[model samples]
Target: MRKIPVKYGIEILVICLTPFLFMISESISNGKVTGILFSFGYLILVGFVIFGIRYWIENEELVIQNLLFWKTRIRISEVSKIEKTWNALSSPAPSITGRVEIYYNKKSIVISPKNFEEFKNELLRINPNIIIKE
Candidate 1:
């Protein structure tokens, strides 16, 4: 199993802290209980943010795991295209630093794997017909 490294882990940490900090101010102005509840929820979100995303080849499919609750599975045979993108829109990608856009069955998803070249090569090994737009 290949673990896709997270390059923007620090950025994610700051993003997750924003809410908690906001809640601290809200607590000072509102109530203690509300602050406590928000803190707990924020911690849970932090856990998810820290874990980020992981991708690996499983069986004959590509598995993208987001946090602990969500996952995306794409069959190697169904992949149609792969391209580099600057799009920062949300998908299965964990970071916006560098992203790979994948097209399959008229649908698309963006992912940011640390070792992009290796990841692309792995996919190409499975499906050579995939049009890769460098």
Candidate 2:
């Protein structure tokens, strides 16, 4: 199974921290306590974002293993269909990020892979029975 690259996380960190850095710098110039607080809060938020992304990337697999939660394994044969879905209102909206929906036994699970096309192709190779819908 493929995993997200470290650069992806770094890129995300840079993107997110840019505004925070700007705010912190401006606050320093103005000498306001609010700016310092905001900077601290943003730092914590960025750390959490980094950790969450890393965890999701590392743990993303067809067969998920969890100590607290039950292990779930999706067999290739059980997959009936694969599709890419998008919606406007969803938090972490599909417009900004792409998602893969895997249909099996009348249920579906969605995962966001770094390389969506390659992920779909691998899944198709594993299960030729899987229908790829536009």
By TM-score, the best candidate is: 1
Mind sharing the TM-score for model 2?
A: 0.51
Question: Any residue pairs clashing in model 1, and if so which?
Answer: none
Q: Compared with the true structure, what per-residue lDDT tens digits does model 2 show for residues 3-63?
A: 4322133444577789889989999999999998999899887665444432122222465
The most accurate candidate by lDDT is: 1
- TM-score per prediction, in order, is 0.81, 0.51
lDDT of each: 0.77, 0.59
Per-residue CA lDDT of model 1 for 9-125, tens digit only, reads: 456567768888888778877878878787878888777755657778887688888778688989978999989898877666666667888899898888877887888888888
Error of 2 at 130 (Å): 1.8
Alpha carbon deviation, residue 22, candidate 2 (Å): 7.4
**lDDT for 77 (candidate 2):** 74
RMSD of 2: 5.7
lDDT of 2: 0.59
